[model samples]
Each structure stands twice: as C-alpha cells, then as structure tokens.
Target: MNDADAQMIARRVREELARRRLSRQALADMARVSISTLEKALSGRRAFTLATVIRLEQALGVPLQKIPAASPADPLVASPDNLGAYSQNAVRWLEGRYLTLRPSFGTPGDIFAYVTIIQWDAEQGCLVFSEAERLDSSFSQSGKVSLPHLSGHIYLVTNVEGQYRLAVLGRPTIQGALYGILTTLMVGHGSQLIPAAAPFVMLRLKAETEIAFGRIEANHPDYVRYRAELDLVTSDGFAHFPK
Candidate 1:
C-alpha cells in the first residue's frame, strides 16, 4: 500500500479504537501483533499491511481500510476459524527443526537464517511452528500450521490485531527441502515498513553442527549454500512470482 492509503487506514483505525473506548495494548493483544509494530504504524512511521488491517478490522468489529467502511462479513465474531483442525496423525511428518532462509529485509546481498521448529501441539490437537535463533528474537513468529488437503499446501499464518504475515509452501522434496513465498512488512530505514515479499526456503536440519544461524553475509561459509536453496523457490517451480 502507498503512503496515502496507509495513512488513511491508520486514521480510520484510530477513530474506531477511540469510538470503541479501547486501549492500544488491549487491541494489540487481541490481534496478536507486537506492540512496537502497532505503535509505529499508528504513529505513521510505518504503513499497515492488508493482513494487519484485516486483523485490526476483525478485532475492532468494524472495517477500516476498505471503503464504504462497511463489511458484509460479521465483524463481531469472537475469533477466526480454527485453522489447526487437521488430525495429528496426518501432519506428524512435518515435525522437525528446519533451517529457514530468506533474503534480509534490512540488508542487501545477505540472507536471513533462523531455525523454525514445527511440533505437534497435543493440547491444541494440531501442528504449530515457532521461530528461534533469530538475531531479532523480539520479532520472531509462532502460529498454527494449516494443512489443506485439496490444495496440498501448508500454511504458517500469524495474525496481529491489524497485521498478518504468511508463508505458503508445497510438499517437501525428497531431499527434505520445502520452498515457498513469504509476504509481510519490511522494516525499512527506520521503523517505516511497507508491504514486502520474497521467496523462502525451509530445509530440514540433520544436525545443529552443520548449519549456522543469524544473518549470513557473502563472506560467511553458509552463504553460498543457503542462497542456492532460496533460488529454488521460483527456478524449480515450487512457487511463482509475477513480474
């Protein structure tokens, strides 16, 4: 979204919050987004992504970004549909610690490397994923895994009151490589964030000894190998991007 549209949405959100007599912290908790991101966007230092706006709309029980400022879908629903309804047995194969790689949003010519552990949530009766070993641990994500049968795709979805970040990947290759795309806000020069997206690769890790985590620069030994893996997201048809 451009600056103007983003500012307009921010204005609407402020109005809705005030009209509802809601505190920012309460809304942030309900939406499950970091307080920092919410403050930045609301203060106009950053732009709101559609996912975030939708989340906020859902949380506030009203529409903000979309004009007519009205929605046919009921906004008063207590919560989103349970995305983790798949059986444990059906998703057991996906549990593991994966070396997650994608281009860095803050740095050019570098790859962001981290660990994503997918595990079975016995209490929730479904699969969930959490990130770790990230340089910015404060922004690490954890959310439910949605495995839809007909589409044969897996989704990692995180929703914050007015923000969301998602990744969709296909079945793992024989080599245990899962390729896909991620869409989320890119932290820019300052707190400013615009809608940004890039391909991501998730490789099942064999041992903690082999891979390194954090920002992998050109000089890092793992850079060459990690860069090649992310390339496969589009080159090998695992996902597509429109030019």
Candidate 2:
C-alpha cells in the first residue's frame, strides 16, 4: 500500500471503530489480525500488508480504500485485481450465445431452457452475460463473468445491490460445453420466492442445431438429448453437490 492508501485506511478504521463502538481488540479479533500488527500499522510504525487490509475490509463490510484503476499497459482488462485479470483476447473464445439448460423448479420431470449471450462490453471493459428466450422473462439474468485461476472455474455472478446470484461452472469441454451449478431464488407456489440450486449446462450455439427454450417437458423431442447433457454435469465431474 502507498502512503495515501495507508492514511485513508487508518482513518476509516478509526472512524468505523468509533461509529460501531468497537474496541481495537474487538476489531483485531474480528479481522483475525494480531493486535501488535494492527497497532503498529495504525501508529505508522509499519505498513499494513495487502492481506491484512483485505481481512479488515471484510470484517467492516465496507471498502476502506479505493481500488486502483486498470493499469495503462492493460487498460482494457478487468479491474480491482480480483477477477483474475482476464483480457478480452484471453477470453475471446467464450464470447458467443449458449443454449442454457437446467432442471425446472415447478415441474418435477421437466427442464428449463434459455439462451445466454456472453459478450465483451467495450464500455465496461469486461465480459458480460444476458439471458434471453426465457418463459419467466422478468427473472432472466444479466451479470459479469469471473474467471479465477485459483480453481480454474468460471463464475457468473449477478449482484443487484447486495443480493447475489451465482453460477460456478467448470472449464469448457472439448465440444465447448460448460457444466456447472446455479444458485438463485425460485418463485414458488403462491408467489413465494425460495432459495434454489440445480445443475446447469451451457452448450455452445452451433449452426444447424435446433434448440427449444423454456419448460421442455418429457416427450418434447429434445428431451432425451437435453437430459443426457444434464446427467453429464456430475458424471463428467464438472460440479458436485451433496444430496
């Protein structure tokens, strides 16, 4: 951290402590940082490490410092240094429309299908996704993609204010199919929304291949093929879920 960052963080920490009526020891315990280390940093005896700052931010539930803008050398790459720094060229292959499939929440033996378009948003300088061809159009999603190298998985994260919905997908297969798990809220009976999770797959849109979207029930000609694709999610080790 630079001098400016250190000063801002120290001021924010002190302000938070006073506002929350929390003692220094309480904050140290909450952030899991040693008292001596936090004391030294606060007193300007030593600089705070990046890890320490991250922990403090998490504990405070607020960002104490500014996230540096993208570097000039890689100006168009994703920013804030947390989304794996994937450049447009590196993720170019992922830019396209996908036939998204998952289990239906209202129908026990049926599937839900939709079209998801992933494309580079030049204005935002990052990849983004938006859904189409959904029966429940209002609930259709749009979000940012996170490709973290730590797990070699792709995360489609949609955050509305503080509410978040996520899809954690494995790397694409030889045929460019992405299998994963989707976590979101399902509108249940009587207009109730409940937390829901299910296996998900995104098949690359191909020329000459026909795909039907929304509420694909058994006996729909595409049912067998789609069912087999959903089965591959676990059989192929794309994602795992406890029963």
TM-score of each: 0.64, 0.68
Predicted model with the maximum lDDT = 2
Clash numbers, per candidate:
6, 0
TM-score of 1: 0.64
Q: Per-residue lDDT for 1-243 in model 2, tens only?
A: 798889889998888788767788878876789999999999888998988887776455445657456666655644234666665555666789999999998889899999999998876777899999999999999999887644657889899998899999986764678899999988877888899999999999987887799899999999999999999998888778877
lDDT of 1 by residue, 1-243 (tens): 988888888887787577656688877876667889899999988788877877665454344554332144523211123562344433545789999999998788899999999987755546679999999999999987876534556789887785889999976664667899999997776788899989988999896467789999999998899889988899999899988
Give the lowest summed-lDDT range of ten residues in model 1.
Answer: 72-81
Superposed Cα deviation of residue 111, candidate 1 (Å): 0.2
True lDDT of residue 78, candidate 1: 18
RMSD of each: 19.1, 12.8
Runs in model 1 lying further than 4 Å from the true structure: 1-84
